[model samples]
Target: MVQPFSQSRVKPEQNLKSLSSFNEAVRLLRESNSIVITTHINPDGDGIGSELALSRALRYADRMEDSKAGLHKPKTISIINVNPTPRNYQFLDVDNEIRTFDETRDAPTILQADLVVVLDTNHPMRLRTMEPYVLRSNAQKLCIDHHLDTSNFADVYLIDEEASSTGEIVMKVVEELTSHQIDAQMATCLYAAIMTDTGSFRYPRTDAELHRTIADLLELGADPTYIYDQIYDQWSPNRLRLLGNALSNIRVLYDGKLAIMTVTQEMLSATATTDAETDNFSTYPMSIAGVLLGVLLVELPDGVKMSFRSKGD
Candidate 1:
């Protein structure tokens, strides 16, 4: 039998505070003329999805405002990133709006923008090559993230540590800005964001309210089965062989409490797979019985990349 999931309720006071922050973020969007939106380097579903969703919502709002006021000018919004979108996530950017940063072209736009919005990551360092440009920008900075231990860099921040993903917060912002009018594209982007960050709604923070929010997304045209297939089921044959190699290399230690898997460069070369293909490989070790901690190490040309996952507190 399936058991009911427990809830992790946010305090009423926290809701009020988050509301206030959302309102302030909306105000900044209304005031800005040119906006540059970016996310952390080696971007994941959460970052890329949030960026696309927010960008669409902002454009929708601008169109409504322009129609109301009989104006011709629309706000300039650009989605720039230090790294290109991962292959699995490229489908979300249907219009191909995301740009891989070219300093000469993007630096001028970042510098001259009226606002710079950083999503899914709070710290500037996470922005990698784009960090210096963001820091040097005279534009008002706004950060929308659910990560903890934020740096004091952004001029306005909407950081909700209790939220499941940055997509959850961006959804609220989209709701407020567009008056609950989210289209299918925005819904798909947001669904991908929340789904990936919450580990398909199985993460520790997947509460009732988060499910309700996801339900709302479904009504707005987010196809869960399709999105899931696109994200997790689209692996190449080579990638599956790579995973097989990793699983074969797993070793148990410390009385079977720890499970470790390594994906060496040789294996990657032989399988014709890259480190990105090993995104959730750490979960495999944790699937073993009696294993409390799972670790995945992938060897790159320069160094070894490590991923860790644990079962409990």
Candidate 2:
């Protein structure tokens, strides 16, 4: 969810007021007890982090209020994502709480939820496995995202495309809604979203505010060394082989303007690359200086899945 005036040169504070509905959405989300948090299908770090971080912030704020008011309004937090996230985020807080859609699981009913915080995704229908439950949920919906195209389905939308990732947007949103200062764990979670989405700060989307946000994250205890060591530096040999096979098929097209790489089913079997291992393989071609766009075609059982990336704006 992005604010309409997000791309303007106006200060974030001024732009923040541009979306007057943001606070309203936050308020509505805060008042609810039974909550469901979700994101788009084929979840990314930004999506997963924003959904989880927002959930934790809201739950903490409500519990704190209960403690102060002497009314134990402990809320039930159930996070249901369309699909599981990559192995990289397995260590983040509340990762275990993230449930895939299952009618049989005694998971809290979506329709019964007092609120649903949809993060990092504009379109709810893209939620795939969680669509049935989401449609069934009577919960008031709020959206927080930075994507360009968004569904206005949420009762309230707080979208800002200027922000590098939903994690960055959620950071500001959390700051506004809670008294808790950003901690090491929270910084790590938010940093993961920003780091991955911004191409480790090399994307054209990176801005002064993004750098400032990261500086604060580091001050709050984000360790780039550790993050890099795990995310990229520690790639397994099989993962290397998987990329090798895919790169072997890369083809230059449109007079070398497009670098296309196709991953067939046979390639997956040959490298023993699990679905998780193939994550982020599409980014490899961006490292090539002459390529303007990188295209990855992954052969699924039913059809081919494509991931497109471009260096040009």
Q: What is the C-alpha RMSD of each candidate to the true structure, in Å?
A: 4.3, 3.2
lDDT (tens digit, per residue) of candidate 2 on 285-312: 6667789999888888778888888876
Clashing pairs in 2: 1-145, 1-159, 1-160, 2-159, 2-160, 3-159, 3-160, 111-137, 111-138
Index of the highest-lDDT prediction: 1
> What lDDT does each candidate get?
0.90, 0.77
**Regions of model 2 farther than 4 Å from truth:** 1-19, 106-108
Give stretches of model 1 more than 4 Å off.
Answer: 1-16
lDDT of 1 by residue, 194-219 (tens): 99999999887788889998998999
CA lDDT, candidate 1, residue 137: 94
Model 1 Cα displacement at 258 (Å)? 1.5
